[model samples]
Target: MPGRLQHKAALITGAGSGIGLESSLLFASEGANVLLIDVNVQAAEKVQKLIAERYPNVKSAAIKADVSKESDIKAAVDKAVELFGRLDVMFNNAGIMHPEDDNALNTEERIWDLTMNINLKGVWWGCKYAILAMRNNPTDASKGLHTGGSIINTASFVAIMGAATPQLAYTASKGAVLAMTRELAMVHAREGIRLNSICPGPLKTPLLMDFLNTTEKRERRMVHLPMGRFGEAIEIAQGALFLASDESSYITGTDFAVDGGLSSCYVTATGEPTLPPPSSLA
Candidate 1:
């Protein structure tokens, strides 16, 4: 196996499938020990089996964690450190959008709370424990190593650009993710613990599918995408691999949008009106 992240240990939430799973497998393939965490214990165990079968001698484990709970977050991190000797990367990727997914004004209070608690606060707890665990690895800057580690939080293209289809709580939570990434980056930057985020566009994952199983909502959501298509979990995972590995050594407090350019594209700014760059004379 390659040493892109050799000897590094990672804990990824929501690693059952999608970006988290892709990243977990990729990281293992590239020579990093991986810890797959999820609320779905079966899913996590399955992923662990897959890694062991494929990588032969790769170091990896899976833990069941809600992510929204502090104790669960702590346990997951502890498991990684105990099994792999240290924590080098943390992917705060577990999330949920409200089932009702209404607009801001009309959104139900319960739904709002649930979405924010899981999507935003869940990420907060992950970062908190991961950073602390990472610091314990002892600085090894002399080796150009990520001894202080990195954190990649999952956000959305909605964090950068709002859409016509309103999932207000989801959008707001991602926006908060972007902010937290920057703040956390600054906080531990001197400690060499970098924090960044991935803002995906429309993804073809169980997470998104579960929300868009309704035909009406799915079509409405697709229409907003200029690509007229959905993005694959593998693509998002590749983006995460970059952020999680030494390749993004100097990159922090940034949001990588893997949304088929949805956030950067514009329809009306150039005025022909279908999806182009937003322009200004300034």
Candidate 2:
């Protein structure tokens, strides 16, 4: 049987590590041709090689690009079309959680700008170029190809809920992403394109691990997780997979929260989770 994303083409930013890396692998496993974009070209190429070895039938390539730059993002999208013949899915997963991004009073202007550039503005650019490419996508009924595509932006649970230990800039940027996704989805609903945001909870990714360096800092957020454990990158990647596939054809304009119930919790339960976290490496 063919995979869910059979014959489709996907472009994922921040493909070097964390959720982006996991999503790229997962998309390829599901039979989509993948273009991996990241500032760390070597890291992306490493993933490209792994995908080639594991999913030999799928096409995959890596390109060095900074999401914050409009030209770079446009080139990445163009590369996808050039290499794969169409753009079926765009996963704007590149983002930063600067260690110094604290509450507004403590966070500097530079940090705020940096966070918005990568997180908010980056998603915007990705969506813009992806839509342009998707509009001209050639129709191939036999292959289930269409003129429009699915776009998934990486928001955060913090965008919906408050964090006492605030990374104000990160939270605000994510909120903007959610809003932008909703409006775009509405605007493009008439067209075949669909737009949505994925809101991930605190995960054990390098980005969050670096911020929650101390046990005290880790525990502070852990206390609010009903799962009593941080999430995994694979978990979020699974969510992205659903959004990218035709399985979610009717789903659009919503914040798909794969947050381990973090957004729903007022007070977390005391017991530990019986289920172990899933790993992409596994």
lDDT for every model?
0.83, 0.94
Top of the candidates by TM-score:
2
lDDT of 2 by residue, 108-204 (tens): 9999999999999999999999999999999999989999999999999988886756799999999999999999999998788999999999999
lDDT score, candidate 1, position 189:
93
Query: For all the candidates, what are their Cα RMSDs to the real structure?
Result: 6.1, 0.9
Model 1 earns a TM-score of: 0.90
Q: TM per model? A: 0.90, 0.98
Leading candidate by lDDT: 2
In model 2, state the lDDT of residue 244: 96
lDDT of 1 at 67: 82
Report residue 148 deviation for candidate 2 (angstroms): 0.6
